[model samples]
Target: MTRDTPHLWTEQKLDARYENLFGRAAGYLPENRAALDAWLDDFSRDVHERRARNAIVRHPSVADLARLIERDRIVRMYVSRMINEAHQRDCKNTVNDIPDLLDHLDCIVTSTPKYQGPTAFPMSALFTYLMMTTDGYAVFRDQGFNKALLGILREWCAHLDSKDSQEVLNQKNGWLSPAALADKKLNLQDFQINLQDPYGGFPSFNAFFHRELRKDKDVRPIDDPDDPRIIVSANDGKVVRIRRDIKRSDEFWAKGQRYSLYDMLDGSDLTDLFVGGDVFQSFLSGGDYHRWHAPVSGVVRSARVVEALMFTELEHTSGRDAGTESQVYGASVNTRGLVFIECPPPIGMVCVMPLGMTEISSVTLTVQPGDQVTKGQEMGYFSYGGSSMCLLFQKGAIEKFFPKDNTGDMEEGDPIKVNARIAQAVGDEA
Candidate 1:
């Protein structure tokens, strides 16, 4: 990932950003310096109590941030103010305060996410509020800060991949529990789960997360798998948007969040091929299938992961879903895996880009360069977290997008099954 100096924020810009975030909220304003100071005193005492009882060991990034805040009075005030603001906004049913946020982070190290509405991504919920602050805008964009944060996420991923993480596969408050299954809309019979083993014999949470579907045509049948001209959905997700006549570069961070081919492809040699092409974007929720598949039958030309920011979102967006709503912006900046497959003529080369958001930044690719892939073949999967995918087609490559026109009874934000036909090539007769 390229690193740049953090942008300097003037007082006017800072206040404007604050107003953009909290201007409509009806409560005590977090901008009050004295109120923030008092809240920090109470928060400090809470942190001390948590440490005394739980013997908490902070994530390295958190510890480093604490040290940094301790040395700088202005930054410390900003941190305290942001935390106070987050506590007030997120006090409904989730992590209500800083200590609770820290406790949830500790819990995530040992346990998997239980299916809760907004709290399914507790870290995101907290950060969504914090990221609206001026300090968060600068700190999250800093190279060194993001590096430390990525390190912490890697460690968490390691734990989730270990066998010890499978302890959460039980019936009581576990991922396999009835409540969780119902909430996630997961059907064990639809997947290749072991009916004999109590926990389906899965070794880890990551294993269960990307569980393979049973090879039943009715479940996820590929639409004309033998036809190279037909493109299928690469993953199970909701169609977010589709854009045509894309530019090489655009103001991706702007309110409309236009697609920028060069930045999205990470300056790849093939980036120019899609300059005036089309992009199909979709989103995967915490409950959706995490594995990615081939959108066309072809030879894999390039497959590699690109390093980028994990938690940063468009600063102008609001709501708990700000990070997710910034998918177009994320396509240019978030940690993602790009796979280029050279198909037959007319269809040309198709680029499948899987983007990671917030805690779901671990993208593991299973296919390598020069490998021949059939349509619907598994290529990679996101370990654990909210994710989205993008399929790029060269100029004039797509004749029609099925989902865009509500073909096959699909509409925007509707659940799309993997391997389902999503689009047709320019030369296709159908």
Candidate 2:
């Protein structure tokens, strides 16, 4: 079927929501010659330079994409620095006094009283990056951080392969049907999504949305960060997987492309990520970070971290210590073990936790480093999403173990679910 008129997602449709977020963050911009005592003048001037620098364009290649992402890292750095500047501009201390500053900072991004939006297209990218960078591997691994551009890039990926084919070149890089959202009435089932594969037939919506929803766009989270049910843990005792990889230079960002960020670090050097001693208590949010959880209870025998897509977010737009702020997951305590399965839980662990979560719950590792657990047994949970778990086993494996267990609160350890309300997305209908 021919898409007569694809609803155009014009530049005007982007969100210019003012984040009334104010606080001091770390600095990541190239410093100017201005003296430290005269910080305001230095910060304002430097931000202009920073934005111009980030706006620099380069050829879109694997090597170049990696450099772009690494350069994009500065966005978080500058935002933190500038936000801190804003806090210092005013005489505010204590977490309780932050509300006014948040409002002040919101003005910087949106139609605030102090200023209007800058020339940056899609300002949300900056916010999205901040959120992504905040989460350590523990969270980022499972949440599709590396595969950030999947939704928007499906179409673009095809174009990259079909460059010489005139017919392919003539085809549209589909983003939306021109009138896809007329009157705000959308029948998701009626939405004809297709991944233009090299094949000659069209794919079903079930097959299309997952494969070709969007192509080659930067990672844009759904209306809510937790809407994807992609957290890395489950209610029943099972293992979960998280993965990370960057293409800045073709070498994997951290561990082999499939390695989890948490399993490789310790509390001493990475102490900032752990909350007291609770792994679940530790979370990463801010700067466009996102998460996904496992949909069913099963053992994660093997996993792979692929360098899926690359798109850059502009960080040099605003000043920090004023209207800009960013933070990574404050705590990542894996010694407590990010997720625990039953005795010998590493292989063939049966689980019964429901596949859905309405909130994030505190997860208690019922088993020790190598203890065993049964299906529906208390493993861990969150009052919301952005959290998930997985399990793993070797190849040629075949076994279905039933539970000698029942669902209940942890007793020997008394597992608990501490609900958290971390982020909110405006106008996210889902």
Candidate 3:
């Protein structure tokens, strides 16, 4: 079960990619330093000091490792061929203005040095904070940028739809083969994969990324359907934060960055429904499953998509913004969708929000409004990169999360499966 040698993405290439990206983005900003300009000065200074003192180490802490255990397990369970499968289909006819950007995407899902080195949180934080400060979010929000990025993703998606992609995946020892690809990443025996098709029964990387598993009692069994109190995980990801007594406006960032309920809900009429609710947020890593499922068996009341910034991690490498939590704010500014589900009785209404980040910004909704959905039923998925999901409960609707203490408070979630019990209803008033 040893892994095959990987085609590594070196740090040199990553830095070069960042340099090019920053240069390109800088051109889009105005010479006038908006309000965020003054803020960046303080932010930059703080980050510089931290790096000078070597405050952040690249390696995971004991806590981080504990949380990453689930993340690593999930990665080992799946093949790395999902994104690589993009190479199999013909994209010659499609217009790809940034062909090189494809390699950047490849680098992400491929290899991470065995040792991730020091935490890049400060820099990550600075970039995310800056975007929020200077309306940098607005720059990435432009249609020109979004259309181009979407076009690139669409090209990759189209390739996944091609027979050629499947043929490559079916190959015995080819680079695109899932078996061989799996060898390059992690031992395949650690988990299960349906290899019914030559290409492992996956049409493309997209299909592979969102692959469903054969029914098993352990992987992610839905709780007793008759029990209306059970709530399942909306997706396979690390729980980032869990909070009770969420107010209409709340701080979501380091040093108290504030976001309003109206802004997060896109000014919907139902905003008041969650005024004093509880909020649960989790982030999907690059290696995690992208598909989302119903957390509760309920009738879909509404589903709406919102367009927002594409790149939320837009900062330099040297500063406090480089902190690992820097991209934390991206969940609020990034393009996302909101799903309103009306629980049969005592539970009332529950809201699930899926937000996109960086290259993984596309959110696809599979279920429509008014559809009756069973707990753990398919809801939607993120297309290409890491993203986050938020579950909003009315004031006291949640009694507790499954395994109670196994949440991702330290590093990530407990590698919970789709359809697995995540929370229980308290039958409280909406």
**Per-model lDDT:** 0.69, 0.24, 0.53
Q: Which ten residues in a row have the lowest lDDT in candidate 2?
A: 112-121
RMSD of 3: 16.9
Ten contiguous residues minimizing lDDT sum, candidate 3: 112-121
lDDT tens digits, residues 26-55, model 1? 111233323333443444455567667876
Q: How do the residues 1-430 of candidate 2 rate in per-residue lDDT, one tens digit apiece?
A: 1211213312221111112111111111112212211333333344445445663222233233244334566433433433343333331121112232222222222210010112111212222213212221122232232332232222222322232212221113221233322313222223233325432123321122122212344222222233321122222221122111211122112222222224322212332222111111112111111122332234432222212112221122232211111111111211122332222322222221121111111222333334333222334322111222222222212122122111111111112111111111122223
TM-score of each: 0.79, 0.24, 0.61
TM-score of predicted model 2? 0.24
lDDT of 3: 0.53
TM-score: which is higher, 2 or 3?
3
Off by over 4 Å in 3: 1-144, 167-196, 216-218, 250-259, 314-327, 402-414, 427-430
Q: How many clashes in each structure?
A: 0, 101, 25
RMSD of 2: 22.6
For model 2, the superposed segments whose C-alpha errors exceed 4 Å read 1-77, 80-257, 260-361, 366-372, 394-430
Worst 10 residues of 1 by lDDT: 20-29
Q: What are the clashing pairs of model 1?
A: none
Better of 1 and 3 by TM-score: 1
Q: Comparing 1 and 2 by TM-score, which wins?
A: 1
